[model samples]
Every structure is written in structure tokens, then in C-alpha cells.
Target: MTTVTTNKSEPGTTTSSGADLHLQNISKRFVDFTAVDDLTLTVPSGTFFALLGPSGCGKTTTLRMIAGLEQPTSGSISIGGQDVTKLPSFQRQVNTVFQSYALFPHMSVLDNVAFGLKRKRVKDTLQRAKAALAMVELEHMASRKPTQLSGGQQQRVALARALVNRPAVLLLDEPLGALDMKLRRQMQVELKSIQTEVGLTFIHVTHDQEEAMTMADTVAVMNKGKIEQMGAPRDLYELPKTAFVANFLGKSNLMYGTVLEDLGDAVAVDASGHRLVMPKNRAVAHSGAAVVGVRPEKMRVMTLEAEYSPSANMLTGTVLDASFTGVSTEYLVDVPGIGTLATFSQNMGQAPAQRGETVRMTWEPEFSFGLDGNEKATEGKDAL
Candidate 1:
């Protein structure tokens, strides 16, 4: 049963700059396929939150549900303190900016911004539109059609339109997907600046890890219709809780091993008779075949004779490939029993190891993490 309620904001009325958005066990299904499953998240007021995942993940579906473009299959959504689960798009205090500019080619920039206000029959539409234009720094383009403006300018116009209403929540669904790489980066900075200036709740849905890390105050990493993990960008990168997050958000070199001892603060593991140590909290299970994870940049590779710390975890491998990309050198090493591993070393005036050379790798035990060897990061991210 569905009930429709008229919860519209009064004409010419804009809510406060921000309001908390809450979702309780939200799910979306299409026939036999499930897009989102039992997802619950709380986005604080005046925050920049990002939902990040791959193409088939439920990030976009979650955003559409918030915008009322798609209804949830179960559960309720609330903004501030009111239940908005059954409300229509116009009845909710939120607006969305899509990847497509969806601008009117024949309409002037000023008129485009004014259209929403005019529909609501608000007083002084022209004045408010100019104010919004000025906020986006496009006031001078008021008389020009959208066709005459550059891609970035047109994007700014769309942002101005959505923001002029002062909706408590501004939903951005890949708003920078249409811009070139350079412009996309530029817009990322601009958008964050604008969101901070307005103090509105911004929920941005995207698949780009770097973009989310660059702009979002908090990031929720999604995978296979569920949230894999959520945290600050640095936390997710440095201390991932799942193999999926470890691989998807950035690069990780995982080595499978069996647990030998569980120290109070760290766990000892044996990978093909070579002992390794990792922080205890990172172990998903108490014992058994576990996986040890280390970021490529954390492990150091040296010639067989170079002196390295004897207390740290060490492994030897034959360099399968080596490539230098100016700032850093990447190496692919093949160990006798632990499979292939990738490592990166910064080029601080030191020569890189050549391919086919025997090298020893060492890293601090604290930098290594223990994970469930059975978990597959490749799941759901590949072709069906």
C-alpha cells in the first residue's frame, strides 16, 4: 500500500541551509534483480557525503530513491525529522543535478535559472535568478543561451538552478561525468568550495575513487548491493576492513597464509614457512588460512646484499617486471610460494631494480593487515 501526502514547502519559502538525511533499511528491487539491499545510512546536516562503487553497484539507485525518481521497495526515508518515504519529488525538500546538463538551448541563462522560481510562482523571480547567477560567478552570461557557454559554465548554471531553491539536500548524480579530465578536476574543487559556502547537505554518487577521496568529507564504499565499508578517505585507504575496499579504493598486495599465533596486539602468520606479522585488529577471523595485505608503497625492495631491518617481515622474490614512471618505480615480483606481488618505490635519486633481479622485500608489521583469504575482491566487479 502506498500513501501520497502533500508536504510541499510554501511558495517562495526556502528551508534552512541543511538538514540531516536518514535512511532506514532501504532496498530496491527490479523483478529478480536487487539493486540495493537492506542499506541504512545517516548523512549529517551540512555534510559532503559520497557513495562510491562500481557501475553495477547500488550507489546510483540509492541516490535516485532519495530524489524520488525511484521508490524504495521497502523501508522509510526521512529528512530532518519528517518521514518522506511516500512523498513526491516536489513534495520533498531536495533537488538533483544529473550528468546531462538538461539545459534549454533557446533560453537565456538568467531565464533558465528563473524557470523553477516562476513555476512556483514566487515573487521577484528575475532578482533571485541574478543572485544565483552571481553565486556561480556566471552573472555576465545571463543573456547568453546555454549553447554559447562552455561545458563547465553550463554545469555551473545547472548547479545554480538547483541551489537557488535552497533545498536542504542537494543530490549530485555524477554531475562531473560529462566534463573532460582537466575540467572535471577543476570542477571537483569548485563544487566543494560552493557546497561549503552554502552549508547545504550534498550527497554525491560516483564511481571515481579519487574524486570521492578528493571532495567528500565522508565516503561509503559500496559493493554488490551493500556497503562494504564507510569512513574517512584516509582511513579507508590506510586501514581497509575488507578485501574489496582494499583493492577497489586503491592498490593492495595480498598474500595468503595460515595463522600461527595471535599476539594481544598483533597476529603471527606463516606463508609457505616464512613468518609474517600483522596487527591483530585487522584479522577477520581468529585462526585458519588468512590473507596478509600491504600497500604497494609501504613495502621496500632491495638487492639481496643491502642491509634491512632483521625484525621486520621479509620475503624474497624474482623481479618479473620493472617500470619507471618519473615519480615512482613499479615492480612485479614473483615469490616461490606466495604468488605474485606488486611494489612501488619513490624515485628519490635512487636507481630502480632491473627485471629478473633477485630482491628482498621488507615492511613494518604494523603496516601489514590480516584478512580472510576466502573473500574475493574480484566478485561482482567483473563481467557477468
Candidate 2:
């Protein structure tokens, strides 16, 4: 995994407090089922880390474990250099924003924000709540009940409630999942902004790839209760560690083949009758069965009649269908030896190719990647 330094901090520089959160071999089981299996990770102070995976992949369970809401069957959790694994939820210096917003339907926004402080018998609770609401730009709505507010406003209230506590770390579980696409995007930006302003460590759990890419300084892609890969958004997207990471994070066109030769920096793969050259990352080696994964945007369309260089990774195929999506065009191409492949082209005002038109598809050698050993041995089909 690569370490990324955001504008909020210098490279290799720790947060002001130097507080590090660690989850050491954390595991949780319910009777016969293991919700989280030996999960381990370290979230640097002030870093926006995302726990991303599909449902039942143990992301939420891991979050609950960190928040002290659920006790781990084994392992330990430490926050700010203190072992808080056995501590109750309130005893730990952490706050959570649930998906439901969990606002008091009857209490006004100001009262709801102040509830946590009041329960703790904190002095000047109203003043603290007003300041929190002001930070969220909702001070004007302090007197309004949750029922009188919109979805976005209610979400802000929830954020204010959590932020008012001034926890060292914040846990958000699909906080924007309740909003529509447009609203979700808006909230994503707002959440990032707030996190930057507060400079608190954020551990967000979500299955949305776009959401993770847009907001997180680092993304940990999980599968089957394990971290498949973890890195910066661009690194994970451009250079995936495994086939599961590649297909899960974005759409990909996979071609099965056997490695014909390894050239240190590049490897040759025999795709049925075609020989395709691909980049040889550390995980990929020579002379073995492998799969070539390419993103749709990396492929370019060419007519069968057009001459192509023998060095290029090209395949003859017929366009089975095409879909125009304003920004890009999607095509299903059927080749004799490769079966069907999905290709996409940016809409640059060019005329769309009609169905039944024979074309040659090509992509750069760097744009293609050979699968690692783990992916080659897995019998399950690719996710995309």
C-alpha cells in the first residue's frame, strides 16, 4: 500500500496530537457466523480512511467494533495510544453518525445537539450546542424539530450532534446513503469540507466506489472479510493489486490467456489465437496461465479494414449493440476467439458506429495488466 499526503498535512508529518488509532487482529463472530474475520488496520490521525465493500463484507461490523458498540470476540483496539478495546461506547473518545440520522423527532435541533452534553452533565451545554450548529451552518434552524427539516438538514443535525462532542475520531456508516444521487454528491463534498475544517480522523464505511474515491485520502477495499487492497484512489483505480480489486472498483473487460513470455517490464499473453502484450507488475510473472484486464476507457475502436500495427494489442470483432450515454458510448463487441467484450468510447462528436459493423479493438500495452497468482487460481468468474 502507498501512503498519500493530503493538502491538510505535509508528507510523513503526523497530526498535531500525534494520536494513532490501531485495530490489531480484530475479529467478531455471532454463534456460527464470523461477521469480521481477523481484520486489522491503522488509521492515522486526521486521515480520511474509507472501509469499502459490499453488504455482509464486515465493514459495518468492523465500524461497530471500533465505536465500542459491539465487543470483539478477539484482538484489541487502541485510540490515541490508549487501549480501549474493553471500554464501553461512551468511555471511548469516539463519535458515530448512523445512517438513520437518529435525531429526536420531538426535540428541536438545538436541544438534540445539546442532548449528549446535557447527559454528560457538561457545563454550558446550550452554548456548546449553538456553536456546533453554527459550524454546520444550521444555527438558524436550532428551534425547528427534525420533522420540520429536510433530509439534508436532518443529516447536518446528526453531524452537529457528533461534532459537538469533540471526539478524537469520527465513524460514519453510509451517512449519505439515505439521500438521492444529486443530494448524495452534495453531501459528499460537504462532509469532506467539514472533515478538513475540523482536522479529525474520519473512518467512513460505504459500498459506493464513487463516494470513496471522491472523499477518502485512502481507500481499503474489502472482500470476504479481508482487505483485498488499500491505497490512494488513483493508484487503486489505475493500478489494481488483484483482479477482484480491478473489477470491483470499476468496470473491466477481462480476457483469459496463458503467458507466452516475460520481458521483465512486459509480459506476452496468448489470448486464444491472439498474442497480447501487457505490463508486468511485481505480482505478475512469465510462463503461466493469466488473465488480461482492461478498463473500457482504455480501449479504442478501429475498422476491420483499417491497417493495424502487429505490435498493438488488437482484436477483430463485430459490434453487437451500442448505447449512447451522452458523455460516452458503450459497445458490446463479439470476437471469434474471445467471445464478447465490453468497450466504451468517449463521445467526442463522432458519429456512432451502427450494429453489425465489423471493427478492430485495440489498447495500449500499459493499459492492460496481467493477473496475479491469487486471481489466476480462483475459479470464480470476474466481478465485471
Candidate 3:
């Protein structure tokens, strides 16, 4: 059963054309498992918010709840200050573009985009659908059937179909998951541009770290049915509060250490008997044990005899292996007691380090981040 309710704005909150989505204390349980646990968030109007996590991390469940596909076991959902907790999916001012384009194979691209508007008895359905197609740069493909279009084009059709309704909030459930790597990257750019042009609240659920970081203004990293961290992509990438965020978002080399001293603007840590310093503001731990982390790309790798800044944190290691990954060379270095660490050095026509060759790794203290001592160093190392 579906119920229609008038839009109601919350006191002291102004309603905008692009609705601000609020998920308060939301929880969802399925028989033996909890999918979403007490998740609370507020996506600002017209913002591109990404729920990023690996599969089974509750990101999809959360999106399903927001789109009215699943009713929360507890808590409330509101958009533009109007409570839609009990409303059916169709009754809410929301539209979704799923991984599976879900276009009508028998219908032309234009008709597929216009289907929803035609059903709603919306005026000038053709004109509105054409406008939506143009938004995705797919207006010229309107006469073709979905079977005749490329995966990328079909994905755009799905986007146009959902967008034509002019929903207050647009839900993108891995909308680019089906496209190839190159096409996915292209679509990511197009999607962000479309979102900017329309200025609508876009709640994108994606497992691709680069996709989330590239497109979202804000990304909430979820784990085990809860959000581990939420912030801007750069913030989350550079200063992750947890080991999971560090390893899952990008390649991070973590070294377990004990806090030796607290210096107002810096913290000293003893790792494998070697002293290291990290910016105090970046340290999640100032006392006891700490996990010092630096992204692979942040560390510079050179021969052991190379001159390095005296203030930089340095480690001597033997090269375990090296891989040329097009733009950069990735080196796996074995630093005795500290275990293996990875470093990425740009390919500037320099000789690649050889296996078993002694090397030195150094990075500025400011680039180092700290995580709580107890966080498992391998927490999200292999996530997805």
C-alpha cells in the first residue's frame, strides 16, 4: 500500500529545489544479519555524496532504504524536510539509476527515457526526455534501441530515464559498474558534470575508491554495517582516522610504533628502534602505541647512498621486487624488523631498482598520518 503525504519542511531549515537528505539513526536487519546499523547522515542540498565501501558493507542497503526499496528496521528518513519513512518508492521524490541499466529492450532510447513521464501523465514528455538525453549527451541516439547502443551509451540512457523525472534526490547505485575501465572513467567525468549542471543532490553508492574520490564532494566510508569515516576525498585519503580507510582508499604503508614523546605540533614515535616524527595534528594517537602510515606515492625511493633531508623519516631496506605500472614504478622493500613496505616512484627515465639492492625510503613528516594503536595493520589491506 502507498500513501501520499504533503511535503513538510523542518523548522529552521529552508527547503531547496534540490532536497537535503537526512537519515537519522537508521538501522536494517535481515534475519541473521544486520545490514545497516544506526547510520546517521545529512547530505546537503545539491551536494554529491558518495557511500563508498566494499560489497556487503551496508552501502547498498543504505541506498535501498533511502530509495524506499527497503524499510528501515528502525529510525527515520526525510528529504527536503519531509518525512518519507512510510511512503512507497514511487511516492517519494526520488529516482534511481542502477548498475543494470534496466532499459526496455523493445523500446527506442527516447521512449525508454520518456516512459516514467508518460506514466505520470507529465506534460511534454518528449521535450523533457530529449532535454534529459541532451544532459547525458545521448540525444542523438534517441531513435536507436538499447541493444544497438554501447554499454556506456546504455548507462547514459538509464541516467536520462531517471533524470527526466526531475527528482529532488537522484540515487546512483553503482551506475557505472558495468562499463569498462576506460569508459567508467569517462562516465565518472560526465556524471559529475551533469550533477553540477543540474545542481541536484546525488547520492552515489560505489565500491570504486577512485570513483568516489573523483566524483563526490563528500564520501562516507562504510564497514561492517557502519560508517568508519566520512569526509572529503582528500581529507579521507590523506588523514584517515582508521587503518581500514588508509589501506582501502589507497595503498598505505603502515608501520607499528610506540609513542615516545608528544611535541605540541609534532609527535615522536619509536618504530623498530628508529625514531620518527609525525605532525601532531595528524596523529590519531599521541600516547601509547600508534600506527604510522604514509601513502606509497608519498615516499621517495632511492639508492641507500642518495642524499636525503635530515629531518625526513628514513628507512633502509632491501628491494624485494619491482613492478613497472606504466606511470610509476612500484617497489616492495623489505625493512628487516618493520616488515615489507611499498613505495611508488614516478618513472622519470631513471634506472629501476633491482631486487636485493639496498634502498632508502624517505618521506616528509607532515605527510605521515597516525591511527589508533589497536587498529589492525591489515584491516582493509585486501578489501575488495
- Candidate topping TM-score: 3
Best model per lDDT = 3
lDDT of 2 by residue, 102-209 (tens): 999989999999999999999989999999999999999999999999889899999999999999999999999899899899999999888878888898999999
Candidates sorted on TM-score, descending: 3, 1, 2
Q: For candidate 3, write residues 202-278 as lDDT tens digits.
A: 99999999999999888889999998888888888989999999999988988999999877899999999878899
Reference-based lDDT, each prediction: 0.86, 0.83, 0.90
Over 4 Å off in model 3, which ranges?
A: 1-16
Candidate 2: pairs in clash: none
Residue 325 lDDT in model 1?
87
Order the candidate numbers by lDDT, best to worst: 3, 1, 2
Candidate 3 global lDDT: 0.90
Find the 10 residues in a row with the least total lDDT in model 2. 1-10
Ranked by TM-score, the better of candidates 1 and 3 is 3
lDDT of 1: 0.86
For residues 66-166, write the lDDT of model 1, one tens digit per residue. Answer: 99889999999999988999999998999999999888888999999998999999998999999999999999999999999999999999999998888
User: What TM-score, over all chains together, does every model reach?
Assistant: 0.93, 0.92, 0.95
The local lDDT score (0 to 100) that residue 336 gets in candidate 2 is: 88
